[model samples]
Target chain A: MIEIKDLHKSYKMGSNSLHVLKGINFNVEDGELVAIMGSSGSGKSTLLNILGMLDEADSGTYVLDGIPIKNLNETKAANYRNKFLGFIFQSFNLINYKTALENVALPLYYQKMPRKQRQEKAMKYLEQVGLKEWSHHLPSELSGGQKQRVAIARAMVAEPKVLLADELTGALDSKTSYEVMELIQNINDQGNTILVVTHEPDIAQMCKRIVHLKDGVIVKDEKVKQVRAKVNV
Target chain B: MFNRDRWKEILEVLTTNWFRTVLTAFGVFWGILILIILLSAGKGLENGIRADFGDIATNTMFMWTRSTTKAHMGLPIGRNFNYKTEDVETLWEKFPQLRFISPRNQLGGFGGNNNVIRGLKTGAYNVYGDYPEIIQQEPMAITAGRFINQSDIENKRKVAVIGLGVKNELYEAGEEILGSYIKIQGVNFLVVGTYKKRSGNGNGEEGQKEIYVPFTSFSQAFNRGNNVGWMAITAKDEFPITSLKMGIVNEMKRVHKIHPEDTRAIGFFDLYEEFNRVESLFGAMSFIGYFVGILVLLSGIIGVSNIMLIVVKERTKEIGIRRALGEDPWSIRKQILLESIFLTIISGMAGIVVGALFIYGVNALLDANGPVDMFMNPSVNLGVVSAALFILIISGLLAGFIPAQSAIKVRPIDALRTE
Candidate 1:
C-alpha cells in the first residue's frame, strides 16, 4: 500500500526555479498493479524518483504500509528503501564488473546475509527470471533483454513490498519489451504491488490501473482490462 | 572488518591495475633500500676504523719525553730530556691508579741507525726493549716460542723476539728460528719468539719488521745506561684514565722540573679521548644518514598519496553504485584504506628483503676479502628494520587518508548521473 498527498518538488536552474511536481495527491491500495503515464515534462519520472526515495520532495506527506516517510536520516531512509521498495531502471543499472548472480545478490549482501544463503537466494531469483543458466555472465556479455531480466531479478531478490519500473523496456526492441511486460504481468498476477511509469499506451494497457499526468498534475485515473503479452516471437 | 568478501574485492581491484600499483610503490621501495644500506655502510666504516685502534687498549696512554717549554726548579726552558728506569717506579708510586706501566727503550730507526743482524741470513732492523706489561697494552701475536719473561729482565739475558718480517728477512721460510741465536750489534741473543702486530697503519707489516728484547739486556748490551725512550701506562678498571694522565703529566713536570703549563713537555697521547672523539663522529654520521633517509621516504609517501587520489577519482562511478546499494560510507573508506595499506606493506617488505640480501652479499664479500681501510662488514641493524616497518605503516595511513575521504563523499545521484 502507498499513500501520497500534496507532494511538491522544485529544482533551481541558475536563478530560475523549475517546479517539477506540484500539489499531487495519489494512492495505491495493496496488491494493485498501476501505471503512471505521462509524456516528457509531465513529471512522471520525477514522481518515480520521489517514490523511490532517491530524491527529496520539497513538501510531501507520503506513507507506505502505515509508516510516515518524512524527515528520515540517510541510514533510516536507506533501510526503508531496502526493506520496502525495489527499482528497475530503464538502463538496467547492473554493475558491469559483477556477474548477473552477483548483481542479484548485492541487496542481500547489504542486508548482511551470510554468503552461502545469499548465493542460494540470488540463484533462486535468477531461476525465477529464467536466467539461471546465464547467472554467471556479466552485464556486458548479456543481451539487452537478458540484462533487463537480470535487473528485474535483482529488484525482486530483496523481497520488497513495492516494485517500481521506470521505462524498463525503453532501451529494448518491441518484441523484447513484450517479453519483459509478460514477466511483469506474471509477477502482478502473484499479488505483488507494482507501479509502471511510461509514456507508451500499450505499456499502460498491460497494467490493471492507469494514472495520467499533465503539467505536474494527474489528469486521469481509471481501471482497465489488462492485455496479456503475446510471446509468439 | 574480517570479511573475506571485502578482501576479495580489494584483491580484484588491485590485480586489475597491478602495473600502476607497482609503479606507485617503486619510490617507497627504493627509499627503504637506500636508507638501510647507507646506515649499514656508515656502521661498517666505523667498525673498520675502530678495528685499526683495537691493539691500543681503550684505557691506555703513551708518554714520551719532549723538550720543556719553560724553566722549573734548576731545569732550563729548552732542556732536552729522557726518562730513566727509576722514573717508571717513581711514576707508579706517585699514581696508585696506574694498572700496568712499562718503561720502554728502543734502538735503531726511531733514534739512530738500525742494528746490523747476523743469523740464518743477514739484514739491518729496528729493535725494542720492553717489559712484559707492554704485551697487555698493545698485544702482538707470538707465533713461535715465547716473549721475554721476568727472569730474562732479572738475569739480563740476551733473548730476542724477532718479528715475522725480521724472520722472513734473516731466515728461510718455514725454517726453525726459535732458540737460534741472532747477533745484533755484535752481541748474540737467542731468538725466543716470532711476532706479528694484529692491527695498524702504513700496513701492519711495519710492526712485523721489528724485534723485541728485555729492557735490562737492551740497556746493558747497547750501553744505553738507565734511559727509557718512552713509557706505556694503563689504569685500573675503576679509575678514569684521563684524570690519571693529567696527574701523571703534573707529576712528571714536578720530577723533571718543567713548568706545569708546558703541555708539550710530556708529549702524552690519551687513547681513550681519541676513541671517544671517533665514536661521537660516527654517531653524528648515523644521525645524518637517518635524517636524509626520512626526507627521501617522505617524498615517496607523497607519491603514494598522489596515486591514491587518482585511483579514487577513477572509481567514482563504482563508489556511487555501492552507496546506492545501502553500503555505509565507512565501508567505502575502509576499502580504500586497506588497499593502500596492502600496497605499502607489500612493496615495503619487498624492499626490506632485497636490502637485507644486499647487505648479506656485502658482508660475505668483506669476509672473503680482508678488512679494508675505514670499512668492514656492512649490514642492516635490527632497530633500523623496525623503524622502517613503522615508517611503512605510517606512510600507508598517510597515503590512504585523503583518498578515502574523497571516496566516502560520493553521492549516489551525482555518481549515477556521471555517465
Candidate 2:
C-alpha cells in the first residue's frame, strides 16, 4: 500500500516561486489500477515523480507499507524505489544501446545478483511480455508497442508492489495504446498496484479508480467501472 | 556488490571511445619517450666529454720548470731555467709517490725535420722518448705495433716505435714499417711497431707525431747532458700529490748539493694544482647538465598531468552512469587511477628499454670502429634506472590526482541529469 498526505512542493525560478504541487492526499491499495488525471501544468507528472522517488517533495508525509518516506535521503530513496516501487516513464526510457534483456536487467545490477541468475530472470520476464524472440534487439529496432512491453517487463521483473507509470501510452497510437493498456490490465490482475498518470479520460476509464487533480490539488477521487481489456486476441 | 563489475563498466566506456583513450595514453607515452631520450643524450654527452680528456689523464700531474738561475747549467744570471736528466732521476727515485716518470728533453726535438738518407732522399720525422708505463696513464690504442720494453733499455738497442704519421712519411704507402729501419739524427733505428693517433682525446699534434724510443738511448745519443725541458708524473695512489711534489723538490736539492735556502739554483711546477683547476671547471659543467635534465623531466610530468585532466573532463558523463548503476565511488576512483598508472608504467618501460638498447647499440658500433675513449659502453646504473621507473609511476599519480578525485566527486543525480 502507498499513502501520501498534505504534499506541497515548490521551486524558485530566478526569484519567482513556482508552485509545482500544492497540498494533496492520495492512496493506492493492493491489486488496484488507479489513474491520475490532469491536463498540462496540472502537476500530474510532478506528483508521479515525487511518488516514484525520482524527485523529492518539499513537504509531505509519504508512507509506503507504513514506512515514512519524507526523511529518506537520495540513496535510501533510490534503494526504496528499487525494492518497493517500479517506474515506467512516458518515453519508455530504455537505454537505447541495450538489448531488451539487458534493459530488463537494469535494476538487478543494483540487486547484487550473479550475472547468470540476473540474465535468466530477465529472460523469464521478457518471455512473460511475449517479446522473448526480440530479447536481443535494441530499443531503436523495436516498435513503440514492443519497447513499452520491454519497459513493462523490466518494471514487473523486480516484483515491486507498486508500478507508477507516467503517460505509459502517450507516445503510442490508438491500437498500440490499447495493446499496452491490455498488458497493464494483465499485470495489475497479477496483484500489482499500478498508478498511471495520463491526460485522456478514455485511458483513465480503463482503470478501477480515477483521481482528478487541478493545480496540484486533488479535486476528486472515485471508484470507476473496470473497462474490459480490448487488445487483439 | 560492485568489485570487478565497475572495471567492466570502465572497459566499456574506454571501448566506446577508443580513440580518446589511446590519445590520452599517448600523452604519457610521449612523456616517457622524451624523458628517456633526454636522459640518454645527457649520458652520451658526458661520455664524449670525458673521452676528449682521456689523453690528458684525469689522475696525472705534469710539471715543467721555469727558467730561473745564476748560471746553474747555462751562463745566464736570473734567467728562466729548465730541467736536466739528473734532476729527473733524483725526483723519480726519491719521491715514493711518483709512480711513473717522463721528462721532456726539448720541444724542437722532431716533427717534419727530414732525416736525410744520402743527403737527397730525406724522410721527414719526429721522435719521443717515453716509458712503457706511460701507455697505461692514457687510453692509448696500439695497432700492428708494440711499445718500448725493458730489454730495449738494457741493451740500449737503437729501435723506435713510429706513429702512423711517421710510418706514412718514411715507408712507402701501404708498406709495413715494423722491422724496417729508420734513420734519426745520423743513427739507424729499427721500426719495432706502428701506433695510430688518438683523435677523440683533445691532445694536439703531440699525440699524432709520436715516434717513441727507449728513454735511456735517447738521453745518451742526444748529448742531453742531464738537461730536460719538462717532466710528468702520476701519484702512487689517489692521495694529493702536493706533499709528493715537495718531496721531489727536497730530493732535487740533495742531488745538487745546494742549501735549502738556495732557491735560485733551480725551478719547479706543481702540476697537481693545475689538474685541480681543470677538474673544478668540469665539475661546474656537469652540475649544469644535471640541472637541465631534471627540468626536462618535470615538464614531461606536467604534460602527463594535463592530459589526465582532459580525460577526466571528457569522461564525466560515463563516470556518472557507472556510479548510478551501483558502482561505489571508490571503485570508480580506483579504475580511473589504475588506468592512469598502467598507462604510465607501460610507456615508461618502453622508453627505458629503447634507451638501454640505444646505449648498447652505440657501444658495439664504437667498440668495433676503434677505441671509444671515455664514451665506451656508456650505461645507466641499474639502481638509477629503477629509481627513474619509480619516478614515472609517481608522476602518473600526480598527473591523475585531480581527475580521479573528480570521478569520485561525481554526484549520481547531476550525472543522470546530464543525460
Candidate 3:
C-alpha cells in the first residue's frame, strides 16, 4: 500500500542544516500492520510524515496506493491525505470545541458529504471504536483511552487506504495504551493497512512486522509473530 | 458556501469566549451609533436654520437709497436722495430679470413717540405703505380679513392691514377688528386685515407689531407725493438676486444721476447672498460630521482587526487540526473571515437600531415640548443607512483580512507541532 525509495529530508535551523531523513528505503504491502521503532533522533516520525503526505522529501520516490507522491501542491496533497490516508497523533488532535461525533465527522465534512450521511458514517465508526456513548462529549471531557478511541474513529471514518499513527498512546498510561492498541489491532484485523510509530519496544511487539531506524537510516526490518493486544487488555 | 457545518463551527468558536466577542462587537456598535447621531444632528441643525428663513423668498433683495458719496452731473457729493415713485417704474421697465418690485413707504419707528392712537390708547408703532405684491415677497399669514389689494391702491382707499400684536393692543378680546377705523398720526384709516409672522428668527415678536396701508393712500394722507422709501425686489426663479444686484444698482445710479462708481449710494441687503452663506455652512457641517464619524468608525474597525488577530492566535491549534483533517486552506480562511464579518454586521445593525430609537425618542420629546432653536427632526435617511451597511461589509472584510491571512499561512505540520 506504500513505497519509499532513497528518501531524503533536511531542516534549516539558522546556519546549520539537520538531515532528518537520509537515504531511506521502505515498503509495506496492503493489510500489513507495521511498527516503526526508533530512538529520539532516529528519523522515524519524519518518514511517517512523508509517507502520510504531510511533508515532502527533498529527493525520493514515494508511492501510495499506486499513486506517486511528489511535488504535490497543498490543495491536492490535502485531497490525497483525505482520500487515502488517516492519521492518529499522540495528542489526539481533536478540535476541542467539537463534540466527539463532530470531530469524527470533520474529514467527511471536508469531503463535502451531506451532513446527515456524514453523521451516520461517523456514528458507525464511533460504535466500532466502542465510543458510541461518548460521541456527544468533547475531547477535553473524555479519558485518554476514550479520546484515543475517538481519534481512531475520526481517522477511520473516511476509510482511508492507509492508517498512520505517530505515538498514538504516548500521552496515555500503560493500561490505556494497551486498550488503544487493542482497538488499533482490531481495526488492522479487518484488513486496513496500518503503520504505528513508537519508541517503546513493548508497543512495537504488538505489530506483525517491525522496521527499525537509527540516525536517519533504517537498520533492521523483520517479520515477527503478532502479539494480539486484546489478550493483554 | 452555505454550509451548516461551517456555521456551526463558527458559532461554537465565537461563543467559546462570549465576553470577548461582545467586547469586540461593542466597538463597531459605538462607532456606527456615533456616525448616525452626528449625521442626524447635522441634518437637524440644517432644518432648524432653514426654518428660520420661513416662507420668505430667499432670492429677493431689499434696496433703499443712501446719500451719494460722489457728485455726478451737477449733483453734489454727500447729497441725501430719496427714490421717487417714478424710479420704481424706471427700474421695472429697465430690468426684465426682476420678478416682483414692491415700492414701500414707511412712517414712525418702534421706539419713537406714540404715532398711533385709538380710544385713548396710544402706542409707538411702525406703519408700512406697500403694494399688493409685497405679500408674495415677504410672506406672512393673514389671520383675519384680507391684505391690501390693487383696488385699495387704485381708489386711494384709506385701508390698513394691522398685525396681530397691533390688534391685541388696540382692540379687546372678541371685539370687532375688520372695518374698524384706527387713527394713525390723527388720520383715521379702516383696518382691513390682521397677520402674524410665520416663523421667528429673533425679531418674530417685533414683526407682529407692524401695520400695512395702501401705497397711494399713505402718499396722499402723509403729503409725501410720489416719494418711495425703499423697494423689495424678487428675481425670477432662473436668476439669482445677488448676481442681478450690481446691474439694477448701476441702472438706478444712471437714472438718479449719481456717480457710476459711488459704492455707498443705493445701499441694499442681498438676502440671496446671506441664504447662500447659510447653505454653505450646512455643507461644511455635513462634511465635518462625515469626517469625524469616519475617523471614529475606522478606529473601531482597527479594534475589530486587533481582536480578530488575537482570536486567530488563540485558535491556532484548532486551525491546525482542521487543516490536518483535509480542510482546504481557503476554507479555513473563509471561516475566520465569516466570523469577523458576522460579528461586525451584527454589531453595526444593533448600532443602527439603537440610533434610530434615540432619534425617535428625541423627536418625541421635542414634540411633547416645543421646537428647539437651531435643531429639529434629527434623522438619517435610508440612503445613509444603506451606506452604513455597505461600510460595515467593507470594514468587516478589511478587519478580517490580516487575521485570515495569518490563519491560512499556518502549515498543518508546524501548527500541529505547536503546544
> Please, what is the whole-model Cα lDDT of each candidate in the order they appear?
0.85, 0.71, 0.90
True contacts kept of each: 0.23, 0.04, 0.53
The candidate 3 chain A region of ten consecutive residues with least summed lDDT is A224-233
The per-prediction tally of clashing pairs is: 0, 7, 0
lDDT for each residue of candidate 2 in B182-267, tens digit (9 for 90 to 100): 66778778878877766764445556666778877777777765566566777765656766766666566555444555565545
Better of 1 and 3 by TM-score: 3
**TM-score, cand. 1 vs. native:** 0.78
Name the best candidate (by TM-score): 3
When 2 and 3 are scored with DockQ, the better candidate is: 3
Candidate maximizing lDDT = 3
Model 1, B231-258: lDDT tens digits are 8889997886887888888887787778
TM-score of every candidate relative to the true structure: 0.78, 0.65, 0.87
Show the colliding residue pairs in model 3.
Answer: none
Best by DockQ: 3
By descending lDDT, how would the candidates be arranged? 3, 1, 2
Q: Evaluated on chain B only, what are the TM-scores of all the candidate structures, in order?
A: 0.82, 0.69, 0.88
List pairs with backbone clashes in candidate 1.
none
Q: Write the per-residue lDDT of candidate 3 for residues A148-201, one digit (tens) a residue.
A: 899999999999999999999899999899989998888998999999999989
| Per-residue lDDT of model 2, residues A101-179, tens digit only | 9888877867767789999999999999899999999899999999999989888877887888889999999788888
